[model samples]
Target: MIDLHVHTAISDSSLSISEVVRLAKDKGISHLAITDHDTTKGLQEAIKVGYEIGINIVPGIEISAYDYQRDKRAHILGLYIEPGHPSLNMLCAPLVQRRKQASYEMFRKIKAAGYDISWVDVQKYEGGTGVYKQHIMHALLDKGYCGSIYDDLYKRLFQRGNTPKTQGIAYIQLEYIDARAAILAVREAGGIAILAHPGQLNNYDAIDEWVELGLGGIEVFHPSHQEDDRQKSMLYAQKHKLVITGGSDFHGFYGDKPIELGCHELGEECIDELLQRIKR
Candidate 1:
C-alpha cells in the first residue's frame, strides 16, 4: 500500500522517522511519504533508512497555508519534493519560527493558569522543529490536566474564536503563507502541489482558484474526509484533471484521533500520475 500523507517526529508526530518508517514497513506499506509540517529536517535520514528497509520514501512537505480571500486554512502538500529546496525553505522557515513563538506564548498562558508545566517538560517531549501544541499538551497530560491530546480541554484552550477575548485563552492567531504562494513554492521546489483535506477546512470554494495557481492534485482520501467528501474530491479531480491521492495522515500518538498507517490506498494509476509529474 502507498500512504501519500504522513508525519514524523520531525514535526508533530510522536514517533521518530526511523520508527515511523519501520512501522510502515511492518504494515506492508511499500511507498510512504514523510510530509512533515513545514520542515524537511530529517528526510534524508528517513530516505536512507527506508532504502535499507525496502520501503520507498517520498520526500514531501505539508505547508500550513491560508486562503486569504476566503479566510480559511488551505494546507498544501508537496509530493516527491526535493528536500530543503530554496523555495520551500524561503516560504516555510518563517512559518516555523512564527509557530514556535506562538507556542511559547501559549505555554506562558497555560502556566499562568496554574498548570504545572514547564519549558523543559515540553522540550523533552518535542522531537523536532520547534514546539507544537501537542508538545504542550503532552506536558499538561502528564500533570493530569487532560486525558488525551485533542480532548475537551485541548479545544477549550486552543480552538480559535471570533475575537481575542472570546477566543481560547491560549489561542494565538498564526500568520500563514498565502495559498497561492504555497502552491507556487511547491512547484518551484519541483513537486506537484496538492490541496490537502479540503473537506476538513471547507476549502472547496478555493479549489478552482487554486487550480489556476497550479494546484495539481486533491486529497480524495483522508481520515477527516467522509464518503461524500471523497466523492466530491474525486469529482473535482475529474473536472480539473488533477491527480487523486490519499493516506493515513498518521501522526502516531500525537494525532487528533486514532488511525493506522497505510489505512488508505492510492491505486497505482493515481500514484503513477503523481510519479510522472515529479521533477525532483
Candidate 2:
C-alpha cells in the first residue's frame, strides 16, 4: 500500500521520522510520503530511514492555504517534491516564522491563564519545524493541564471559535497563503499538487475552481472520510480527470481517532498515475 499523506515530528505529530519510517515498514507500506505540515525538513531523514527499511519515501509537504471566498483554510499536499526546491523554501520561510510567533503567543496566553507552562516546555516538544499547537498541547498534557490531546478538554481550550477568551486560555490564529498561490508554488517546485481530503473541506463545489488553478489530484481515501464521502470524491475525481490518493493522516496517537499506519491505502494504479504527473 502507498500512503500519500503522513506527518512526523517536523509538524504536529508525535512520531519522529525514523519512527514513522519503521512503522510504515511494519505496516507493509511499500510507498509512503512524509507530507508534514508547512515544512519538508523531515523528508530527508525519512527518506534515509526508508532506504534502510526498504520503503520508498516520497518527498512531500502539506501547505496551509486560505479560500478568501469561503473564508476557510485548506491543506494542499505536494507529492514527489524536489527537496532542494528554492520555491518551496521561499514559500515556507515566512510560514515557519508565523507559526513560531503564533505558538509563542499561545504559550504566553496559557501562562497568563495560570497554566504554569513556559516557552521552554513547548520548545522541548518541537521537532525543528516550529512550535505547533500540538506541541503546546503536549506540554499541557505533560503538565497535567489537559487529560488528552484532541479531547473535549483540548477542544474547549484550543479549538477555533473556542478562543482563549472563551475558554480562558491563550490562542492565536496562524496565517495562510492564498490557495491559488499555494498550488502555484507546488507546481513551481516541480511537484504534483493534490487537494488533501476534499471531504474535510466541505466545499466540493470548488473542486473545479482548484482544478483550474492546476490541482493535479484529490485525496479520495482518508481516515476522516466516510464511505459515501469516498465514493463522492471518486466520482468527482473521475469527472474532473484528477489523480486519486489516500493516506492514514497518522499523527501517532495525537489525533482523536486511533489511526494506524497503512489503515488507509492509495491503490497502486492511483500511485502510478500521480507519479506520472510529477515533473521528475
Candidate 3:
C-alpha cells in the first residue's frame, strides 16, 4: 500500500522524520511521501531511512497558496520535485517570513493575556525555522495555560479569522501563489500538482474551479474525510480525469486525533496510474 501525504517535525508535527519512516515500514506501506507544510528539510533524513527500510519515499512539499480565481485559500502538494527549484524557493520564502512574523505577534498577544509565554519560549517550541500558530498552541499547553495539549485549536485559538480577545489578536497573512500560478509552479518543479484536502474546504464549487485550474489530482483518502466525502472526491476525480491520492495527514503527538500511518491505502493500480501520469 502507498500513503501519499504526511508531516514530520519539520512543520509543527511532533514525530521526527525517522519516527514517521519507522512507522511507515511497520505499517507495511511500500511507498510514502513526507509532504510537510511548505518545507522539505525533513525529506533528506526520511528518504535515507526509507531506503534503509525498503520503503519508496517520494520527496514532496505541501505548499500553501491563495486561489485568486476562487478567492479562497488552497494548497498544492508537489511530488517528486527538485529540492532547489527556483520557483519553489521563491514561493516558500515569503510564507516562512509571514509565519515567523505572525508567530511573534501571537506570542506577544498570548503573553499580554497572561499566558506566561514569550517569543523566545515560543521559538523553542518551534519544530522548524518557521514558527506557525501550532507551535504557539503547543507552548501554551506546555506552560499550562490551556487545559489539554489536545484541545481544539479552532475553538480556543488560531481559527483563522476568529477573535481570541474582544477585538481579536492581529495575525499574519502569508502571501501565496494563485491557483493558476501554483499549478504552473508544481509543473515547473517536475512534480504532480494535487489538491491537498478538500474536505476541510466546504466549497465544492471552489474545488471544481481548482480542478479546472490545472489541479492534476484530488486527495481521496484524508484523515478527516468520511466515506461520503471520499466518494465526493472520487467522483470529482473521475469526472475531471484527476488522479486520486490518499494519506493520514499525521501531525504527531501534538494532535488530539489518532491517524495511523498508512491507514488509508491506495490501490496498487492507483499508485501505478499516478506514477504514469507523473512520467507524462
Candidate 4:
C-alpha cells in the first residue's frame, strides 16, 4: 500500500518520525509520505529511518495556504520535496514560529475563559514545531472536559466564526501564505505541489486558479472525502492531467478524525506518477 499523507510529531502528530514510519511499514505501506504541516525539519531523519527499515519515505510538506479571493483555506502538499531546499526552509521557518505564537495566544484566551488548563498542560501534547489547537484540545480531553478531540468543547473553542457570539472563544486567525506562493515554493523546492483534501476545506472553486499557478496534483482518496467528492476529484484530475494521490493523513491522536495509517490502500504507481511530474 502507498499512503502519501502522514504526519509525525515534527508537526501536530502524537507519534515521532520513527514511530510513525515503523507503524506505516507494519501496516503494509511500501511507499509512505511524511507530509507534515508547514515544516520539513525531520524529513532527512524520516527518510533515513525508512531506508534502514526497507520502506520508501517520500519527503513532503502540507503548506497551510489561503485563497484570498474566496477567503477559504487551501492546503498544498509538496511531495518528494527537497527537504533542505532554501526555498522551503525560508518559507516554513517563519510559519512555524508564527503558529507557535498563535497557539500561545490561544492558550491565554482559553485560560482567561476559566478553563482549568495550563500552558504546561497543553505543552505535554506539543511536538517539535509548536503547539497546535489539537494539542490544546488534547489537554481539554485529558481534563475530562470533553469526550474526544472533536467534541462540543473543541467546537466551542476552535471553530471559526464571524462575530463574538458565533466565534470560537479561543480562535485566532493566522495569516497563511497565498495559494500561489505555496505552489511556487513547492515547485522551487524541487517537488510536485498537490492540493491536499479540497473537499474538507470546500476549496474546489480555487483549483483552476491554482492549477494555472503550477499546482500539479490533487488528493483524491482521503478520510475526509466522500464518494461524490472522490468522483468530483477524479474528474478534475483527469481534466487537468493531474496526478491522483491519497493517504490516511494520519496525525495519531491529534488527528481531526479517527483514521488509521495507510487506510486508503492506494497503489504504489501513484508515487511514480508524482515523480514523473517532478522530472518534467
> What lDDT would each prediction earn against the true structure?
0.91, 0.82, 0.76, 0.89
TM-score of 4: 0.96
Residue lDDT tens for model 3, 1-280:
7888888888878777888889889888888888887766767778889999899898888888776766678778987776668887777777777777777877776677677777776677676657777677777777777765557543444545534353345354557766567777777888888888877764356666666656788888888788888888888889899988888887777666867887455766766877898788
lDDT comparing candidate 3 with the true structure: 0.76
**TM-score result, candidate 2:** 0.94
TM-scores of all models?
0.97, 0.94, 0.90, 0.96
Write the candidate numbers in order of decreasing TM-score.
1, 4, 2, 3
Measured with C-alpha atoms, the lDDT of residue 109 in candidate 2 is 73
In model 4, where is the ten-residue run with the lowest total lDDT? Answer: 263-272
Of the two candidates 2 and 4, the one with more favorable lDDT, higher being better, is 4
Evaluate model 1: give its lDDT: 0.91
Q: What is the C-alpha RMSD of each candidate to the true structure, in Å?
A: 1.3, 1.9, 2.4, 1.3
Q: Candidate 2: list runs displaced more than 4 Å.
A: 162-168, 263-265
Backbone clashes in model 2, listed as residue pairs? none
Model 3 poorest ten-residue lDDT run: 162-171
Global lDDT of model 4:
0.89
For model 2, what is the alpha-carbon lDDT of residue 36? 88
Q: Which candidate is the best by lDDT?
A: 1
Q: How many backbone clashes does candidate 3 have?
A: 0
Top TM-score prediction, candidate number: 1
lDDT of 1 by residue, 69-181 (tens): 98888889999889999999999999999999999999999899888888999999877789999999999999899999999889878988888767777999999999899
